[model samples]
Target chain A: MTAVLEVEDLTVRFYTEEGVVTAVDGLSYRIEAGETFGVVGESGAGKSVAALSVLGLIDSPGRIEGGEVRFEGEDLLSMDESELRSVRGDEVGTVFQDARAALNPVYTVGEQIAETIEHHLGYPPSAARDRAIRLLDRVGIADAETRYSDYPHEFSGGMCQRAAIAMALSCDPELIVADEPTTALDVTVEARILDLLAELADEFDVAVQLVTHDLGVIAGTCDRAMVMYAGEAVETAPIEELYYDPKHPYTAGLMSAIPRVGDDDDRLPTIPGTMPDPIDPPPGCRFHPRCPFAEEACTRTDPALVDPETGEAATLDDDRAAACLEYTEGLSGGLDYSVEVAGGTGEHVEKTIDERDEGGPDE
Target chain B: MSLRRFVVRRALSVVPVLFGVSVITFGLFHLTPGDPVSQLVALNPDVSAAEEARLRERWGLSGPVWRQYLAWLSNVLVGDFGRELRTGRAVSGILWRRLPETIVLGVFGWAFAIAIAIPAGIYAAVNKGRLGDVAARVLALSGVSIPNFWLGLLLILVLSLYLGLFPVLPPSRLPLYHPETLRYLLLPGVTIGTAAAASVTRVMRTSMAEELNEEYVTAARARGLPERTVVFKHVLRNSLVSVVTLAATLTAGIVAGSVVVESVFNWPGLGSEFVRAIDRREVNVVMAITLVTAVAVVLANLLADVLYAVLDPRIRYD
Candidate 1:
């Protein structure tokens, strides 16, 4: 599949009074045509900043330190203001988290959508108004013709999200970046919104960059997922593989934390500690301080993102890759764990490992 | 609570307010130590006791305070605001003649303030923390700090006295549309407008700065709209709710400033007329002018409420 967007070594920093915050540090990823790529991380992992940097929306004090964000072979980072304007709404539409605030309160939702159409497509007011109504109907808002005149306050939270989605699809953009589109919505509405997003992505043949902190959201909508830790992608793999066979320790910790229906555990397990300060992150592996599988070498060597089976740096085309010392054999003490694979035939294959050798540590 | 009903209710509510204002102003003037008859007699000793008593009877000053207030209130309700004691002219007629002059000055000052404040505010907000913003802050500070009367004196000194760009005293009775009359309006208009513009600029700058940081602004920019579109269409529109409120207050300020400004420029607006009426102890004229000003302040606030509904969709009069 042809890549619609190829982001390489995208770094973003914020010059705050406290110190320089390395928001997105050396992040690299890609989204192919019609694919749904999810970037999942805890808050402050720079998911939103990295996505905004793609559209060149970072304001003052926050700068894109260095990066190559190529959209259809055109370098977006190098584009001037006018050029970026053409790419922003026309080429890549954005759906912000707060749909209510994302819309202008003074203008009708229809007028706002029509404004985008008029600006990018140069459609006349009459034609743009009709197009906006059709777009609104396509996003599942009933009585679109009449609702087009209603202000944003007249729309409910779910309807606002639908309106926002309609707006993003107004110009038939090649890509859509939805930053926590359904976060403000309730659970039932969130499920419907996610389903609608997936349906629209397929229908328009548009690549999507879905940024969220919810792993369940990523699993429900994304075809491939990248797990970011401390502004870096620690693991990226197919959805099923990432969920069932997570390679990195962080990913494993995240998966195990999900509460299954029949489980009777009194307290849910949680990863120890919070995200490190971006201004002064720990040396070597950024996650070493909180990682349960950390070893002496894990504190001394930062592992590169690599194919877990071969121990080599993984390229963009790799289907599965993780960044961990255990994968690269850099850890003197190997990780001791078991794989319980739930087979499709209802059979379970349990592969257990013996304890680490008590001999002197292999340097 | 439709907008029509809401407006009618607000208008109805103004009756008690005006009544309260009229009663207070009338009572304060009457309750003062010196009586109008006594003052008139003292000013002109050639008047005999019979003439003084006749004057008191003519002006209906020989009664209890409440009875006098009720007499005036009844006349006002019937649309005859009584006669000015000093001029023996109908108070309503005097107000009608002077109203336009004050309005002309007030409107010009208001126009000047808005014209200066909106652009200066937008510039300062867009270039926040820059040299332009610094200069705008300093200008606003000076505007708010320096009284309009002082500013009026300075403008007259520099622009009128030194440069001879305008006359020291405006021509007595020229129509407002005449070029000669408009030229006479410049210094006083600028004087009143400058102080208000300074306040408005500061409010606009603050409101614009806050609105620019809103998520909608960021979203608008992300849609590939031009910077000009984002700033003018989205940012400015949102900021107007607050700015409109400040503008209403500035309108009242212009009216108040016109009192001193008109006196200084020798302009024949209601402000100067009101001042002259107060000095002469023409109780009827003073009460009428006070009521007019009270109504003006009330109407300005009403306009602000209406504008609030217009600018913010979430704010319903209902």
Candidate 2:
């Protein structure tokens, strides 16, 4: 399938007073047509910065130093200001996390959404407003016609997020970059919003690049997942393969960290250490300082992502990969794969793989 | 209660404060070394002792101090400013005639400042850190730092001397009511207004800059709204409360600072009348001018507070 959105070797940096801070370090991923690609990372992992770079919104002192963000086969980085406007809402819409702050307080929700429609699609005021109401209705807002005139402050958090989603879909853009859309919501609201996003993506035939830190969310909504560690992707694979047979140590640690819903365990599994500082990040492998199975070479040389030798039958379409030294040698060799790697072919007669490296904790 | 009620409450509270202010002013004027009666008698050496005593009685200076205070206060409340001892002219009449000139200068000065400052401030903010912003900042800094008196003198020298525009002194040849009289007023008004305009523009620019950085601005950009529409229609209105409040307070300050400007230009305004009243030992006129000035300040501040509440919903009267 053709890639709907492709980010190639994206690097974003900020020239601060102290020094140049690397926010995103050579990140690369893609979302296929009508697929949900989840980029999971912590706050400073440059997820938002990467999204802003796609929209050409990076301001002074912070910039896309090196990257190509291809949205629907068009290079966004090379577009001029006027050209970028055509792409921003008409081609690639965005739904920010903080819905209350994202929407203008002075304008009614319908007015705000209608503005996007008028600018991008050239809809007349009446038609644009009707479209706004229809979009709001589609997003589960009741009394869509009447409540369309209400300001952002009058809406609840969940309702505001829904309105923001409606605004994002106003122009029916091909790609939607939802930056931490459900992070600020309660558990119930988060589930509803996630389900809403999934349903909308299917109904609209639009690709979604969902930026989130929740691994479970990635498992539920994303076709593929990118695990980010200290501004670099540690693993990228189909969701089931990533959860079942994660190869990178960081991905393994992340899986172990998820608490199973029904497990009656007193203590939950956790990964020790914090994300490395972007400025003066660990020289070789950025994750070496925190990796439990770090070798001397792991600290001296960055491990490049390569296909693990899982034989012809073991690989998934020859794309799923991990950035770890253990994966370089034979996968079934006597390596310290303390974490279990679950759900692969059992007929490949080879050396033993660690049984403890099983599937990710179930939700 | 509503904002209108709050303003009334605040305005009413000022009366007691003004009373305290007036008592202090009256005591200071009386406690000074020179006695007005002795000064009057010394001016006319041929006056006999009985004749001088009769003159003092006529002016009510012969009354006990407490009775004199009560009489002066009662007369002031009734709008009967006592006659000046030297010229036998009622101080109220003098103020009524001259107050218009001061009001004229102040109104024109304030209007000019606000007209020029608002757009300049918006430009400076939109083009921040650019050449226009730099130039505007430098102009404002100069306006603030340069003394108004010196600036008035320089304008008089440049515009009056080289161009032969306005008169060196006020247009005393023509009655102040004549049309040509405005030319004389313009130079002084501009001198007083420049500093105020500069300060107002700087404040507006700072506020606009802050509003532009808000998350809503980012969201607006994300929605594909044009730059001009985003700035003028959205950011400017959101940021207006602070700028309007600054301009209002600055205009009030200019009213007070006009004392020096009026003196330098020799325009027959309240400040000139005030200084002359002081020199002539006219206590009633002096006290009345002080009361008027205090009232002007309090009212101006009240107007600013009221406007703030109107412009920003976040502002509420407690």
Candidate 2 per-residue lDDT, tens place, B34-89, comes to: 66778878988998999878877887667676677677777878888788777888
Taking the tens digit of each residue's C-alpha lDDT, what string does model 1 give over B199-243? 889999999999999888888888889999999998898898989
Deviation from native of the Cα of residue B282 in model 1, angstroms: 1.1
Among all windows of ten consecutive residues in candidate 2 chain A, which has the lowest summed lDDT? Answer: A310-319
Q: How well is candidate 1 docked (DockQ)?
A: 0.80
TM-score of 1: 0.95
Is model 1 an incorrect, acceptable, medium or high docking prediction?
Answer: medium
DockQ of each: 0.80, 0.38
What class would a CAPRI assessor give candidate 2's docking? acceptable
Give the top-scoring candidate (TM-score).
1
- Among these predicted structures, which one has the highest lDDT? 1
Q: Which clashing pairs does model 1 show?
A: none
Q: What RMSD, rounded to one decimal, does every model reach?
A: 2.5, 5.7
